[model samples]
Target: MGALGAGIAALGAGIGVGMIGSKATESIARQPEASGDIRTAMIITAALIEGAALFAIVVGLLSNG
Candidate 1:
C-alpha cells in the first residue's frame, strides 16, 4: 500500500508538471515577449508540485513502516 501511495503521488506530480509545461509553452507562443516570465513561473510551479509529491511519498512510506 505504501508503494502504491508513493506511485500515485509521483503520477499526480508528473501530470501536474506536464500540464504546467504545456500551458506555459502555449502562453510563450502567444506572447513571445513574456517568455521569460512564463518560463520562470513554470519552473517554480513545477518545483513546488515536485516538493509536495516528495513529502507525500515520504509520509506514505513512513506510515507503512
Candidate 2:
C-alpha cells in the first residue's frame, strides 16, 4: 500500500505539471513580447511544485521503508 500510494501521488504531480506547462505555453503564445517574464514565472512555479512533489515522495519512501 505504501508504494501504491506513492505512485498515485506521483501520477497526480505529473498531471499537475502537464497542466502548468500547457497553460504557460498558451500564455506565452498569446504574448510573445512577455515571453521572458512568463518563462521565468513558469519555471519558478514548476520548480516549487516539483519540490513539493519530491518532498512528498521522500516522506512516502521513508514511511514505507
Candidate 3:
C-alpha cells in the first residue's frame, strides 16, 4: 500500500511538472518578451508542486513503517 501511494505521488508530480513545462513554452512563444518572467514563475510553481509530492510520499512511508 505504501509503495502504491508513493508511486501515485510521483506520477502526480511528473504530470504537474510536464504541464508546467508545456504551458511555459506556449506562454514564451506567445510573448517572447516576457519569457524570463514566465520561466521564473514556472520554476517556482513546479518547485511547490514537487515539495507537496515529497511530503505526500514521506507520509506514505511513515504510515507503512
Question: If scored against the real structure, what TM-score would every candidate get?
Answer: 0.95, 0.88, 0.95
Alpha carbon lDDT of residue 27, candidate 1?
Answer: 99
Which parts of model 2 have CA positions greater than 4 angstroms off?
Answer: none
lDDT of each: 0.95, 0.85, 0.95
**Residue 24 error, candidate 3, Å:** 0.3
What lDDT is reached at residue 30 by model 1? Answer: 96
By lDDT, the candidates rank as 3, 1, 2
> Which residue pairs clash in candidate 3?
none
lDDT of 3 by residue, 2-41 (tens): 8789889999999999999999999999999999999999
**RMSD after CA superposition, every candidate:** 0.6, 1.1, 0.7
Question: Against the true structure, candidate 3 has what lDDT?
Answer: 0.95
Tens-place lDDT per residue, model 2, 1-65, is 66776777788789888998999999999999999998899889888888888887777777886
lDDT at 65 for candidate 1? 75
lDDT per residue for candidate 1 within 12-46, as digits (tens), equals 99999999999999999999999999999999999
For model 3, the stretches where C-alpha displacement exceeds 4 angstroms are: none
Model 3 residue 41 CA deviation in Å: 0.4
